[model samples]
Target chain A: MKAPSLQNTLLVTGLFTASFAQAAELEITVENLTRGIAFTPILIAAHDMESHLFVTGEMASTELQAMAEGGDISGLEMVATSVAADMATNPAGGLLMPAMSTTTMLSTEQMNTQLSLVAMLLPTNDGFVGLDSWTIPETPGTYSVYLNAYDAGTEANDEVRGSGTPGEAGMPVPPPLENVIGMNGTGVAASITNDKVHIHPGNIGDAEIDGGSSDIQNTVHRWLNPVAKVTVVVSE
Target chain B: MTIRLLRMSVATALLIMLAACSDDNDDSVTEVPEEPEMRTFEVSVFNLSANQPLSPIAVIASDGGMLWHTGEAASDGLEALAEGGDNSVLIGADSTLGSTSGDAPLGAGESEMLTLSLEAGSETSISVASMLVNTNDAFSGITGVDLTTWAVGETKTYLPAVYDAGTEENTEMAGTIPGPADGGEGVSEGREALDAVTMHSGVVTADDGLPDSVLDSSHRFANPVMKIIISRVE
Candidate 1:
């Protein structure tokens, strides 16, 4: 677990040069910290600084939109391939239920100094949990980062049940999520205000389990920022 | 960044001087620098729930490991802590350098400080856990936190978020809770629903339209249910 001293390594090489020659193996653990929401297959990718999954204040790419709106990772997987990023897709097999964690080992190749993760938040139209391009520390240590929910800005959050297709109107309630999520929720909103990727304002679900407002449970599905925690142990 | 550079230069000069003083052939006397003491941290948790008191605080000090990570199922020890407000099992099982607990329950707005000391070593992390007594299985605590740069006598304060132990279900029934709010049952062993620790969605009190809930709005809370302060005490 011990790496060469960074002070000595820096003395012998340039900061960027030393980074190019040495890469740390990352042990990543992701936890779903919600009482009710379920996450579709998560996508964890390590890429160079040039690659980005989704950025704020910009329109989501068709690939990003697909994953955010439909819980599909095929489009994002292609994007990861295009950037030559190291990726681990759907490590949990299918949906990651509440209070569940998926532990995975990821080793970054030289030049992949940034990490990005994305997964659709079940019972939502275009909502997803996301971690944007975070700089990987050069120091060998364990780092923890909390992720927040985001709106992909691709579709309206109708809060009802419908198709899982991209650009669809309502939320896609899969089997496990269907039983938990309420049915015939009137709707949350007809459209979105901000048409770019942004922090999700959290679901505004009603207390009624049978039918009132949102299909999602209010006291159950609601969450603050940092809905997920990522613990990365960097090894030499 | 300039001040950091100055500090590094000073350290480098001191290190070079120390290196120069070393003799290749030490026949008489030699001096070896003492390894750094493992950093020790003392964390105190204060329960601030209205009708919901807290179970005994579970204080654990580890290098960088977590007792119960989010999205993970509550271990038996953590489940015991969340369900019954008992820290005996968790504190007993914690493999940290040191673990301690408050003697009695911490009531609403009333605070008590429990001291935990770890020998100074490379392991410079601390974690503290506790449960709200009125709910089904709501608990809260700070997790593997780096206390490396905290100098002796310095103090750090935080308001920790509440977490559902995910052991017992959040039924909020009168006979399910252990706090005075219910004067109800304690730990009943049974895996109800999703058995994993997650962020507590908070109580759906009888005041909030959950007809079955024994808790009222006074029992509800938002993020940061507890104010935690950690001080480095040699």
Candidate 2:
């Protein structure tokens, strides 16, 4: 909401020009804090002050839907490039396992003052952990920020095995994650309550491995807020 | 520049010449000096969950180091404290500079104050942890929180998130929970379900989808389980 004001100042003021001309060097580390949830290929972007990958309470873009549904960042990368964003994509090289961390050194170009990040959560139809347009601190120091899971609100969370393509109905059963996941479930919710992006209500998994409404195990798939922790060390 | 350098040297010389502790073996005790002032801190904690009573809170001040890490396994002291409503082992941890504990367990919506004292000018960090008595191996606390900025009579408050001890599975069984709701066994030897400490996934009571769970909907809880307020009393 406040991005335009920041951009206008950057355009009009000589004072802002001095500070906005130089790029910022950041050592970014993302840690998956969940016990059982695995994060798919991650995307980190440093975009212009007005740009955002996903905004809460707003409709999910087609690019966002693709990533949330299938753990694909190609669409979102196009959006970032269109906005002249500096990005580091999939630094972990693959899906980030639980309680694991990945570090990426990214430099934000001039006027790219805001940093945003997104990564799909495996075994979920459209759930992804996200950080939306956080203003990069100017002072050189180490800072910690926590992230929450957001639902794309485009597809129904069927909680069953199905396709990962956008507009698909069920969750994508990635082969590596299948060992911890259950099988032969019925389904969870057929539709969503809030259509716009919103906080995920977490997974409503059941214990029945052979046949249950949700194929995901309740104790294994569930998570609380601040699902991921990001430590950003700005070295000027 | 010369004057400024001389002034700085004089100040350093005075500071170096000043004796913090006098030698007791000396024949004459030159005006027996009193002990250095102590920094007293009052740590206040309030339980905000639905029905989860907190074990006796452990309020500690340390020079450095962390209370816990996200991916690391819980210490035996932490396991004992999280699984049961016991804080003795954690309070006795070697890293603690000074620590205190509440006399009784703090119930839901209740508040308690714990106090700790340390010699002044000791670079200190604050840490407080307490078990959620209703759950299995779930504890809420803070770690390596910098409270050295507070002056005497100043207080800083914090909201701490709940952490799974990762020492036991959150089965929500009748015979596993230790609170008044179940009055079940507390602190088993080894019932770890996960590798390390992480945020609690919240209680999935019977009312929610887990039909076999002993917990009801009333037993459910969310993050920010405790509000901790720390004050430098002296």
Candidate 3:
């Protein structure tokens, strides 16, 4: 270790109580790293270990179905409030555009030690980006986490123009997606193969423009895992 | 003991120099400029895909520029290289501080090494990119990999994810791909796909689905397409 000089004081002040004693002022940045898929209204919450936005290999809850089917975070917000979770809803204010990024704050309470996030992937059936109950690091400088796309298994991926209502088969087309998404499609998948929530097999788009099996362009709507990148700058 | 002897010699020299300076009142000063050191790195890349022949690797060390960023449109140089497997533009582009390319195209299960040299002082970030010649605009690379803490004799390796340069459509049509598997044209001018670069949704060859595809099951590929091993040799 170096001597406790003026340089040491500056270093100490620069890296304050970043370790986990709880009650941290966290500055979280969410990056929509995908090329063509837009994220509908992201929701980030800091809760105890008991709370989870969505669990893999489990049936989708009615509240989670509503958010994954549509772009509604209201139901999830109410659930977080009931759980006494420190939450930040709709951090991007609206649809987080492809390749864009947004930042939000979560001044976590002592009891809320785990972080979770959820957002819908536009132009898809029941697809969402999820971070399920990741333990908030106590000793933190800057932490980077990559998130993958998941299927809610609540609706079949018809890949056609339909309603945003829960239990719907078609994808909800926001105004921003009206001009972008194609129209008059036959269907991609007839039913959800995996009844339980699982990793998305990704969209299988086609090249036909006027009419095709799927409305999604093969070149545009498809993506790989780890679609979004989340960076958390945790401080005292 | 060495410090004491060195201190006595320096004191005697300083006394003699002070006497000389006082006697002459000289104002002249001499300065010797220091030479800047250069660092060299050897990057060996292995094409790990099924049959996609990788284009000549582009190895660059930069300060802050990104060779290719996800969600952004690929530059003209990147589009040319991704589409045609030609690296002339990316090597001479203004974005790189120092760059080099492999001697030849690396085939499937083949490996090649290229040496790159850069001036010191800047916290250099290494960027490596190569095209999967059989697919339309499919490239694999690492952008802004920090090499600031690297020392001589240290080696680092990475398995990079594949990317779809959203510049050309992945139609698998005839005369679209530039690799020997297709023997089609290269570097055609157009932006037909989504305007943003994204993760490569694996190719749907003819055996899998796409009826008009020039490719077959042998042309299909997945992520972590290339294995890159970088060593600081200097």
Candidate 4:
């Protein structure tokens, strides 16, 4: 026990140090790919594997419904804070417009290895772009994930101008996007037929920009899956 | 037995020397000879349609560049592929490394495998494309997927979602669709009513209230219209 060999100590310590250096730092970038859609202030969280901000086919929680229906992230922010997640709120400082992107650096504080992002799609009743918990890779490389649009299932897709409060009747077209929306359009539909969170049937815009069944422009407002492209670079 | 032991010891020493030589070579690549090497990948594509038959597949290996981007207008080559399912122009278009096409069209519930081999170190990304021939200008595939993570003999499968080329309108008219459903026009010259590309709203057939549409409800489709798998075979 008293052999006091220096090389063995240095080797063991070096191995431990190398293991510590292997932890990854990620650079995350999110792009809004819609032609006319606007994303509300986004919320990105790095949390444990056991938690999820939103899940499909389940009833939307009060917090998620609040964000999806009204483009408000306060309730969801409170939830992420409750779990003590490494979170970034409103990286774009406001709405992320079509074809625009925002980047942020995420530092994972050990055991927090999953990433999730959420933002309400503007000019919709209750649609949002979502990237559910994706595992952060341990290897150093660039990874890309595309996000799809989801219905919050809390309100009917009336596709008209209305309130930003939860349980509202129509979509909230914020001030900057207000002028582009149409006027004098009868509501698209009036019933909350599907009550569970599911894939959005997509917006049904009409040919008449001045007076259509929906306020959103069919040519400019329609979108496909992968509404947002996210690029993540992991660094050792 | 002594000779066998000698050979074993020689092999062990050679392996150690080789490992050391590789590490040194990593630092001094100037002495290494540069030779042309070939990298190959096989693209397995599946048609996930009820009735809409896809055109022959077109696979291209290119640099980390995009063949097309959403919210932008389509190039002439992409316009040709979207309108008619004729990949002749796209296969030879710009931003291409190497391209391969299927022998025949893929019908409903069918599959096709096309092998695309590229010269090693020539390209960093792969783009696969094909047309949903029954629609006006809808196509589905992947673009600019980096290949550094892929290795020889490893496979990666991708389920592709449909995209509107934004070159032609989704008119669904009788003489507009190029597939057997219409046997109509392919690659009409001119501009579309809307020039920007977006997610396809899907085919609105006569059953869905588009009376002039020659297509039926069977032509309808959802997000992921095709399934694709790529393996670096060599």
Each prediction's DockQ against the real complex: 0.02, 0.03, 0.02, 0.03
Give one digit per residue, the lDDT tens place, for model 3 in B105-171: 8876556677788877777898999999998889999988887788999988776888999989998
| Candidate 4 residue-wise lDDT, B87-193, digit = tens | 88877866777889987787755566777777776647888888999899999899898886678989877877789999887889988989988999999879787
Candidate 4 colliding pairs: none
**Which candidate order results from sorting by TM-score in descending order?**
4, 2, 3, 1
Name the candidate, 1 or 4, with the larger TM-score value.
4
lDDT, candidate 4, equals 0.80
Q: Poorest 10 consecutive residues of model 3 chain A by lDDT?
A: A13-22
Q: Ten residues in a row with the worst lDDT in model 1 chain B?
A: B1-10
User: TM-score of chain A for each candidate?
Assistant: 0.90, 0.92, 0.90, 0.89
The TM-scores, one per candidate, come to 0.49, 0.51, 0.50, 0.53
lDDT measured at residue A100 in model 1 versus the true structure, 0 to 100: 97
Error of 3 at B97 (Å): 53
As a whole number from 0 to 100, the lDDT of residue B207 in candidate 4 is 43
State the lDDT of candidate 3 residue by residue for A89-163, as single tens digits. 898999999999999988998788999999999888888998988778887689999887877878877788898
Give the DockQ (C-alpha) for candidate 3: 0.02
lDDT of 2 at A54: 90
lDDT of 2 by residue, A93-180 (tens): 9989999999999998878889999999977879899999888888899999998877787787778888789997888878888787
In model 3, which regions exceed 4 Å deviation?
A1-21, B1-208, B211-234
Instruction: Provide the lDDT at B198 for model 4.
Output: 78
Model 4: CA > 4 A from native: A1-23, B1-234
Docking class of 2: incorrect
